[model samples]
Structures are given as C-alpha cells and as structure tokens.
Target: MDNNKLIEYLETFGALTSKDKLCLIDNVEFKAYKAGDVFLHTGKIANQVGFIIEGVFRYFFYDGQGNEITSYFMSENQFVTNITSFNEYTFSSGTIAAETDCLVLIIDRKGWELFAEQIENWNSIISKITSKTLLEKTNFQRRLINQDAKASYLSLLEQNPSIINRVPQTHIASFLGITKFSLSRIRNQIANK
Candidate 1:
C-alpha cells in the first residue's frame, strides 16, 4: 500500500537504504482499480509497470471467436507488465485486468529510467529481477510441457493454495490448461483423496 512495501520487496534482492525507499516514493505513484477494470488492454502500448499492493490481475487474450483465454494470474506483491511491449515498444498482445479491487504502485518508463540511474546497484537489481521472472516463466513452461492437468493443478495448489480462494475457477482452469468442468472434477478428486 506504500513505498515501504515496495522497498521491502526490493530488499529481497539485496540491502537497500532509507534513501532508496525515498527515491522510490519520489518516482512511483499509487493507483487504485475496481474489480473488472482494465489495467492494460490488448493493442495498447504499456509504458508503465505496476507492483500489486493488493488484489489479483489476470493476463488474457481473446481468441478468434472472441472467447477470453486467460494466460496467467498475478496476485499481491508481484510486478505486472507487458514484457514484450515494454521491451520493444510495441502494442501489447495480451490484456491485464483487475480480478478484484486493487491498489498498485506504478512507475512509468521515464520514472524507471531515473530510478535506475539514481538507485545504487540498479543494474544488479535488474539482473536479479530478470532472473526471477525467467525462473517463473521456465517453471510455467515446464509444467505445460511435462505435467498433466491434474499434476499442474496440484503443483499450483502446493505453491499457492490461496489461488483457489482468490481467483475464479475459469481463470484457474485456463492457467492449468483445463476447462472449468475439468477443474471442478479435479477439485472433487482431490477432495475425495
């Protein structure tokens, strides 16, 4: 909800001083969104990144038939951005929307550039961020390639049990590459065990 939280997240990579926190306060602003609000829409360019202070967001894309296919969900304390659009300055291919009423710390491209220039060990922090993001992506890819739907769902349950409580079944199904009906079946099976 504040720079303190952002600074705390930043500290996970390394030590940061009070000065770093203050700099973040100067560079980032807080924004609030109501449930179902569009944070970033497909075809729009995303110039800012957000740190989720509270609530959930889903990354999704519409199919040719206009059905939404959710790619992932991001929860509290995580960063959300269109990586490709931000890096290449292209239109975003996916949409990010608020799954619940939310509060986020936002930093625009210019702010991030300035913050990186001013913050100590900023490159190291960027390296650390890149590593963490890649690890998450790799794990997601691994699950898609190597795990069955039931196994994937179980792994998610093990790592983030609260996800079932936080996001809708359809979104969870999409993330696990299953249908809502299949998710219900999986939950029933797990419950019976």
Candidate 2:
C-alpha cells in the first residue's frame, strides 16, 4: 500500500501508528470506475464507503418531476458515500456516479468495523470526519435557504471553482437550484462585470 493514495489521504486526518497502518493496509481495496459509471445507483443499499483518489463524482436524485437534482459534487482526496443509507442500512435515496475515470479506496462495513476495533484513536478520526460533514451540510442548507440563485452560484464559484470546470453546466445549475438558462445568464453577467 506504499503507493496507495487512500492511505496517504487518511494520514491527513491523523497519524496512524505502524500497527494501525498495517490494519488498514490489510483491509482496504482499490477500485476503478470509468467515466459515467453509475457505481452506486439510487435505491441500492450502500455497503461501502470510499475515498476518491482520482476522480469527480456527483450525488444526484430524480425529483418528483423526473428531473435530476444534484445535491453535491466531490473531487480528489474527498470521501464520497451515501451516509444516510450506509448508516441506516436502507436504500440509497440518490445515485453517486463518476464524472471522469476514477480510482477510489473502498472500505466495506466489515473492514471499517475491523479498522475501528484494531486502530487506536480511530474514533477521533471518525469524529473529525463527522464534524466536517455536518458543518458542510449545515452551510449548504443555510445558503440554500438564505441566498438567492445568483448569490448561491457566486458562492459556489468562490468555494468550489474547480467544480465549474469539471462538472457540466447543467449539473452545476441543478446543484445551484437554478435553471441552466439562469446559470448561463449569471455567468454572462459575471463575465461582463
């Protein structure tokens, strides 16, 4: 696992002892998905959590009117999982698909349980991860509730400029809770200014 990007990324959260590293090395698996692959589809039970070593993905769901509503987009060094389904062992409410050829480090439920049991200070790492996720969700919700489309789009540009280039315009529009036409107008407005 010397060249594994997942292990390298995990080290950012906390330093894993030699023993802890070995435990993770033994359990984590590497997987690759092609661009446009729907690795985890809606209504499926999400059993594995993964770290994006190289790729971009979006969490999307079909709204009642049969339109795709993208909730979030994630890129390299990020964790992408349907947390609600993974935690509850229920059907996933959305789909997670790669936007480009991607590599990920996956830890299954059993592997995660073993890692937690064997690794010291593992709970601290998990707690930090949980805290970050919560904060992001809270901020996103607050923005959606308080900010209009143009402000939300501008916020996205400020916070995640890379996403505008990696993801399609339509997906970005959906994530911003705006129409593609509206997104185009916003872009033109910004460009002219």
Give candidates' CA RMSD values in order.
1.6, 1.8
Error of 1 at 25 (Å): 1.1
Provide the global lDDT of candidate 2 against the true structure: 0.85
Highest TM-score against the true fold, candidate: 1
lDDT of 1 by residue, 80-121 (tens): 888779878999999999988889999999988887788887
Compose the digit string of candidate 2's lDDT tens values, residues 1-193. Answer: 2435766666778888888888888888888989898868999999998888888899999988999999888888788888889879999989999988888888899998898888877878877877887798779768877998889988888877877888789999998888999999999999999
TM-score of each: 0.92, 0.91
Pairs clashing within candidate 2: none
> Residue 14 deviation, candidate 2, in Å?
3.1
